[model samples]
Target: MGNNQPTEKSVSDTISDAFQPILETPILNIISEIFQPNLEIIPKYSEPPNYNKEVTNVYILKLTDDKYYVGKSNDPSQRYLDHATESGSAWTRKYKPLEIEKVIKNASHFDEDKCVKEYMSLYGIDNVRGGTYSSVRLTNAQKGLLTQEIRGAKDCCFRCGRDNHFADKCYAKTNVHGENLPPKKKIVQSRININELELLSSETSSD
Candidate 1:
């Protein structure tokens, strides 16, 4: 009886231990797989955001003669297109197909408005505005004429009264007679020396 009891007890205890190990092995594996300290599980969100701002600058375009169109813009290329396509203002509409001569950026920073105003005042009011007729269009001749007129009005020169001629040919000069007269004295120092030498030689030969 004691021997049978010992065998049954040992078998029952062995089976119970085996069942516990089977159940606990899977649970342990699941817990380890799910709750273990994983370094790669959390997603990283480390990317930079984007931002930008508008910018302001100056632009210039060349016109006929010495004239130009000065303007301001956030984008110079866009502003240039706007002027040509009549997109923004009446000025562009009136002056279609404006030829861009040059572009001057940051003109506001350089006091461009003051410079343009001064240029207009010196060149004449009409110089800033384009003429109505093709004949009146700003030309190289018209530019020269305007420059002459401006200089004449200022009484800048006595010769041409405009900047074309010099002071030597000045019609306003009072020394007209002096201008055509010959030089005061001839340079005869070399001639005098030669003559003295010849006379000394002739005297020595006679003696």
Candidate 2:
């Protein structure tokens, strides 16, 4: 009850609290405003350059003559226009392309190959020109040569230059198209006609 007055902090106590280390201070879930000296800076993620190619689509065009052409492109509309104008494919030009019937987006060449084969099976191989691979083209040409043979035509295959089962069942990997095959040597047989022989005899008798 004697000298009831509020006491103030001592000068030495205030000085010691002011000089305390910051690490000793209590904190609640606070991050630093600046980075550490030894920290590594990571760059943000970026897309690839061939991202468009990776997301390209496999599509099918329905011709006016009930045929189908399977292909791959990122822009199906432009590709369809090219086919409609008769600038895309020989098959499309011959059959008159109508419109795009199907489109499988984000497709690869392998996916295109499978789609083409499926279309070929659905609408006979002769009606389907199929995909744009070397194997597909070579196979179609071989089938054409086989059809020629079935029609009694003496046309050799564009691949091996042979008329028999060479083209009918050829499983060649590349589209050599008779490039590596040996050149065909022509056979000429000279036969004397009856009139020519009689004239020769008369000339010999007169001589």
Candidate 3:
């Protein structure tokens, strides 16, 4: 006859194993509670900053006429308002009134002056700095010629200024051309000869 029995761990061993899981569970829950909110808030501080600086230089166009007004200012909005007012300068006064069609902003002082000059030149206005228009009328051919003259003056090509050959065939490269030719190489010539006496001796022996 055999007795049926169940193997069992000690009471202390059971308590120890259960106590470890209970201790570890509370630790994991506490760690998760502390870290989750920190992860959520970290992204908010990492965003980029925004800048809203205002532009200062501008171009004003008249809506009703062929005239365009180009000028520079530290404050473009104020300048435009002043130009539209009743006490504006003689140029704006003669035009009777004006409307701004376009505004170019944030140009350097030199660039602003150049832009104003170019625009005045295009519209056949003289004394661009003071907004003075000349009464002298230019024919189309004359206008084209004047434009070319101004452009040539601005460019001031050396060959054109010197009245020499054009830029494409300037003499500056003449010395450089002489230096580029291939250096000379020496060659020796030689002649080859066969002796008639040796050939005759071999032929006689063979016979």
State, as a TM-score between 0 and 1, how close model 3 is to the true structure. 0.35
- TM-score of model 1 (CA atoms): 0.31
Per-residue lDDT of 1-207 in model 3, one digit per residue for the tens?
Answer: 676676688999889998987677788786887776756656556655432243456565462356555665676667767767735455554453356656666755455546655665555433232222222343576544544554454553233222344444444432221323223233578654468767988999999
Top candidate (lDDT): 2
Off by over 4 Å in 2: 1-53, 133-207
Write model 1 residue lDDT over 1-207, tens digit each, in one string. Answer: 356554445887888887986666778787887888866987888866532222246555545455445566667788778767768444445555456545554444444454444354454534453212123346776655654554555555433343555545455433222334333334476545888899999999999
TM-score of each: 0.31, 0.41, 0.35
By TM-score, the candidates rank as 2, 3, 1
Q: What tens digits encode model 2's per-residue C-alpha lDDT throughout 1-207? A: 697786788998788888676546544322443433444565667876775556678889888778888888879899999988878887787788777899998887678767765665455556777565323245666766444443333354545445554554654444323235444444699998999999999999998
Better of 2 and 3 by lDDT: 2
RMSD of 3: 20.2
| The 10-residue segment with the lowest total lDDT in model 3 | 127-136
Per-residue lDDT for 79 in model 1?
A: 74
**C-alpha root-mean-square deviation, each candidate:** 22.6, 19.2, 20.2
Q: Which pairs of residues clash in candidate 3, taking residues 3 or more apart in a chain or in different chains?
A: none
Stretches of model 1 off by over 4 angstroms after superposition: 1-56, 63-67, 118-124, 129-207
